[model samples]
Target: MKVRVIDNACRDFKNIDYTEVSANKICYRWQIFLEK
Candidate 1:
């Protein structure tokens, strides 16, 4: 899958805090990124 890495990092578009994000959510975001 193609992943979009802005600033050479994966992040949750809706949430600004990376520390609070779960691994599953990050994986989900990656899926969304691949779909885009």
Candidate 2:
């Protein structure tokens, strides 16, 4: 499950702008996921 999330995140990341804001958003999302 975790791997799938990461894979999807990576794929999505590649399709979007690689900016600091986006990176932070992804990190924030992972933090939330980890908290759960």
Candidate 3:
């Protein structure tokens, strides 16, 4: 799975540590975001 942060601020943050985050974690967060 591929995830891209579309927000400018989030893009900056993603450039930092997001490379280390697992795909499953990203998917889990996406699921939570969609539920909100």
Q: lDDT of each structure?
A: 0.53, 0.70, 0.52
Model 3 error, position 14 (Å): 15
- For residue 9, model 2's alpha carbon misses the true position, in angstroms, by 10
In terms of TM-score, the best-performing candidate is 2
lDDT of 1 at 8: 29
lDDT of 3 at 35: 56
Over the full model, what C-alpha lDDT does candidate 1 score relative to the true structure? 0.53
TM-score of each: 0.40, 0.51, 0.42
Q: On residues 1-36, what C-alpha lDDT tens digit does candidate 2 reach at each position?
A: 776776677557757877767766785687578668
Ranking by TM-score: 2, 3, 1
Error of 2 at 26 (Å): 0.3
lDDT preference between candidates 1 and 3, better one = 1
RMSD to the hidden true structure, all candidates: 4.9, 3.1, 5.9
What is candidate 3's lDDT per residue for 1-36, written digit by digit as tens?
Answer: 233432433455566666635544665666567556
